[model samples]
Target: MNLIKKSAIALCALAMVFTACSDDDNDDKNTLGDKEGILLVTFGSSFPDPQETFKNIDNAAKKRFAGETIKWGYTSDIIINKLRQGNGEGSLKGQIIDNDTPQEALEIMVKDGFSKFEVQSLHVIPGEEFDELKEAIHAFKEKYEGVSVKIGRPLLDSDADIKAVADILAVKFSEELKDGPVLLMGHGTPHAADAQYLKLQSELQKLNPNFFVGTVEGIGFDAGTTSIGGILAELDKLSPKATKVTITPLMSIAGDHANNDMNGNTGESELSEQSWKERLEGKGYTVNTVMKGLGDYNEINKIWMDHLEDAE
Candidate 1:
């Protein structure tokens, strides 16, 4: 009876040891920190060239953070819906992913078992979209107890960043400056963050007298210095000898606003009534519009990478 009891105890102990080993193996297989990735969130564009512009930014990020998997998200529901519905413009219909918001991208990463990752904004300013992105991250952080996440800043986060952007723009439009005034159009917001556009204008003006910035939203903080009207008035006061004005987007992608608001036609019968290009031409200044987003510049895109590297 004693031998039988000992034999039974030995078998039980062996079974317990095997079960512990199996559990350890399972834990190793399901380790929480085993994978990580990056998600680049932006306002999104359906325009063909700007779609490539986004790809360029993504490529730069992949090169900068070589090993990590990189993903993308668009903050605009209208754009995403258009892309998913196969109605996006040109060849870009196939390029844009279908996620409507950064939260969806985060949910996807979580679903894919990414235990850690970073969310980087491609926004030019820390305005409404960036604020919404932060809220999404906060919610995810609460829900995903074991997942680690970090966020990167927008392009114009600090005075130093703004100056850097100005320096790059100075280099980019060096030749154009000689011909005429270079006006950059930023998408303005009612949020106090619109101050960034004014600061950017100041920085660019400090770099070169001919450089200016204006907004489409007419929320320019200064008493009379942000709309196309305000900029034109200021130009009239300066009486620049240059006979031409070069216009370009200060936003990440030169999509709807850059195409229609800044360079579209101006007529009672036209769809766009008062474009910057038409308004400047009407003022007797020859207009030159550069329909390229800031992200199209490698130097400008590098600023985003620097921001990503700064994230902890």
Candidate 2:
């Protein structure tokens, strides 16, 4: 009887040991982090490219500001646009909304107990949106009382920063591109876009004048389509049939303007930018638009890398 009892106790002990080992293995397999805490903030991503573009910024932040959690605070427009575009199942470009605003995003995070935020704007310039964001961030900080938040600078803070970005932009054009004119597609706004594009165009030309450089906006350029045609017309006048045009976007990360306005083909609206390539071809010039974003380039990635330091 004593031997049987001792054998039963030994069997129970073995079962308990096996159960503990199974639990340990299961914990290892499900190694994911908790989302209640992190660092960093931005407007919001409507599509994957802009989201991924910001992700590139986050990745840079990760490399330099290691040992910190990076959290994203996105506007309701991103959520709504994403959902209306079939629950974020489709491309992010379709995620833009007419009524989207920024203040509510920070409010959502604060309501959820976020105490600190490095509110960075992905806006290309310090124009209306950036100005509004700066004010909203300030209001949020003042209202929160115990929390901390700071607004980061725009992409057009200074020309050295522009050259830093332009030098980064320079790497994308190959040396073979020396014979081909490199045209950058920028969102020429009624406000600062022309000045910014002019600055970027000058910097790229300075970097390498072996290629001609020009920019046309989605709006604000005098005779919008004509500016592009004018550049091509001049190139045609100079080189005739030998013109090799490489068009790349000058915008912060080609979200909608790069993908839709520059590349879309059905010629949707008269207000839409007539295909620059089609226009150049009509003038007998060989046209090629480079469909890549500045954010993805290694050197372009350095822009955020340079800024993350100030983030500290």
Candidate 3:
């Protein structure tokens, strides 16, 4: 072959090799690595005290899955916006809190070399928030090919879960049960999963007649079975007539719903929108409030951890 022709062929072959190498490099950049990460997604609370509940869950997850990358995601845009705007009430007031949404958190993990993720939902029920988290994860997976993600179910995903939570509550509120009825106020949803509240109530009643469950939104399979009015009716039916009641939140964190809707005081006027405390007081019964979340309880947190383990 002529020297000029051979030289030209050699140069072309070398250029093809370089092109292949560049393509390989680009592929490597898009592909995820072998590292695993845990993303705990919650509806999120703007209240400062509830932030501790998230911290507790994060710490527990880190302890359980030591050396694994762990991060948090807030599913609620309203809470995220409030925190970012420094409009968060109480301790969060005037302090801008930078928290990531589920999508952003997952992207951060991917950038940090996490390829496998166990996305756990810290929601009380598999309701709207939980559904949105799932959708976000789905979109994330579509955006990032070759990444593996498994989602942990919410706190109450099945009848077994309801029963398990009921058992925990029975022990958690044993002392309150002795005094009189213990009312648990959950953040109810328009979603069908709201019926889980009724199932939980039934389970708790089986454990102790003094146990009752209600919702702030007054939604469920039967609103009458999961609302404050329903609780009042049941309270009246309590044999021997209960003279006192203890109210507590069934949510992961005792934030706005627990503080305002369940236990808020709206002055002495009988006409104002009544909180659970005021309603119970108006019923002529001694009422007490417990401002704590389910996450505050180790056993309840363990249940969530178990769900994560199952997902893994």
At residue 209, candidate 1 shows an lDDT of: 89
**Candidate order (TM-score):** 3, 1, 2
* Highest TM-score model number: 3
Give model 2's TM-score versus the native structure. Answer: 0.70
Which candidate do you rate higher for lDDT, 1 or 2?
Answer: 1
Q: Which candidate order results from sorting by lDDT in descending order?
A: 3, 1, 2
Clashing pairs in 2: 39-69, 39-71, 47-92
Model 1 TM-score, all chains together:
0.86
- Give the per-residue lDDT of model 1 (tens digit) for 215-285: 88873336533888888877887764568889999999889889888988757565546888888888899
Compare the candidates by lDDT and give the number of the best one: 3
lDDT of 3 by residue, 181-230 (tens): 99999988889888888889899999998888889988433553377887
What tens digits encode model 2's per-residue C-alpha lDDT throughout 192-224? Answer: 534766666668768865344345543323432
Better of 1 and 2 by TM-score: 1
Specify the poorest-scoring 10-residue window by lDDT in model 1. Answer: 25-34
What candidate 2 gets wrong by more than 4 Å, as runs, is 1-51, 73-102, 210-226, 237-242, 268-273
Task: Candidate 3: count the clashes.
Answer: 0
Better of 2 and 3 by lDDT: 3
